[model samples]
Target: MGDIERALQTFHSMRVSAIMPPIFSMPIVAEDSPIVDVLKLLKTRHHVWVVNNKDEMRLEGLIRYMDVMNVLLPPEHTKARLGNISSLFKSILGGAEKASDVMERNVLVIEEDATVLDALKKMKRYKVQILAIVDENGRLVGEVSLRMLIDEFLRLMKLGGAQWTQHGSSSRSESH
Candidate 1:
């Protein structure tokens, strides 16, 4: 098979676990954690996963940097509903205290057993760069990122003896 074909095949056949980052590397905060803590984590990462306080393994929600920004500084075009205004003031006045108060409750996730191709498709469909990986019991495990997928694809191509060039074509193939 050609290099591209081989890469595609590998992506389709390989499970998400093959590319998922270690669970400990993921920033996780309890739902009851102060929003300040989430913000602290967001300083170095795009988002933080929120888990149930009573059961840390269970996935609860996620807080993205944009989520905090939106709550604290709503878009100018946004209509000032009473609730929306209240949330903004609360956030500014320290009333919006916990991660759950500002988290996006419906976080997109992928099963750990899913294929890399499945993860790519889900990420594309959801227009997201990362996905929280869950096990069969729906416990938070780790994460798979678009960058990881790209790196894995490049590694697969190299293993297939294909050297990609700036022109987007294989310059040469190494002999087995």
Candidate 2:
């Protein structure tokens, strides 16, 4: 079988827990945090941080690279724009915002026990590059990237078309 075939097979046979990359780290900020602060965090982080009210690590949403880029783009340059400086000031102040204001809340998520195929399907369906791995309790555990999946798929192909095996099963854990 080929890499895609093997990956598909693995997705059918194993759970996401088996092949997910070990959690490196995740940056987080409160839901009502100032956009400036979130921007600062994004500047020195891997992925967008997530947070809820009370400054808790709820992983309620994500701010991807594109999200930041969208924010950085001048409003006049895009169809989505604030009508006046007052609106822009409100956006910068974070007072006129909600967690849903700047977050990709409708994110694709998969369980740790879900098959790799599940992740792949979700990615394809959503046309996204990343999937948030959540546990049974609905807590964010880690993220799975398309790059990680491709690497694993390549490794499987190198196994001389052998049955897919998990490279590692360690859970990528994170804390607030």
Candidate 3:
């Protein structure tokens, strides 16, 4: 009936397809891609990169920031010490020599038709900040970030607040 109510309804019905923004970076590769290259792609562009093993780009898995960080920071006394930039570089170069070595095969993805609330819940449950928005064909279309959600929510709040102020002023004038 009012702006706030309309906003709430819109939020409840918003599908990932409608709210998801364009994909930031698509660093995709086959199974045999070098891990070092993948790491470079992730570092320079995306926090997560998708991988496909078959002919079709089926949702295989995601490589995350933590995975790359782990390779960069190896266990103590293995060969090199921590805090050494050279050692860190060597470790990353050594371990992630191959993409399969460092890639996180377990990836979480969301469908286009899923509600924004569903995406929020999934992100909260996984403690992740971003989710890949995919279609039924398993093709990545866009992404949804927490910042985007917060911005949209704040915009709705402002709209609702303005509507309430106008309604209050009108009611006061009528009473007078």
Model 3 misplaced regions, further than 4 Å: 24-31, 44-46, 53-55, 75-95, 157-176
* Model 1 per-residue lDDT tens digits across residues 40-93: 999998889989863658899887777676556544533457655534433534
What is the C-alpha local distance difference test score of each model? 0.80, 0.63, 0.65
Model 3: per-residue lDDT, tens digit, 1-176?
Answer: 65566666777678877777655445666556777667777767556555465355565566666555657766442344466433333345454465555566666788888988898899999998888777888776667778878777657656565244645431111323
Worst 10 residues of 3 by lDDT: 167-176
Top-TM-score candidate index: 1
Candidate 3: C-alpha lDDT: 0.65
Candidate 2, residue 136: Cα displacement in angstroms equals 2.3
How far in Å is the alpha carbon of 107 misplaced in model 3? 1.5
Q: Between 1 and 3, whose lDDT is larger? A: 1
- Tell me the lDDT of model 3 at 116: 82
Root-mean-square deviation of candidate 2 = 9.4
| lDDT score, candidate 3, position 154 | 57
Model 2: lowest-lDDT 10 consecutive positions: 86-95
Kindly provide the TM-score of model 1 when superposed on the true structure, using C-alpha atoms: 0.83
Q: lDDT per residue, candidate 2, 1-176, as tens digits?
A: 44546455765666777776564455656677767767777777656646564323456887765566545555444344556343232232333444345666666788888876788888899898888887776667777778878777767655534443475322223346
Q: Which stretches of candidate 2 lie over 4 Å from their true place?
A: 1-8, 32-37, 44-46, 53-56, 73-78, 81-101, 160-176
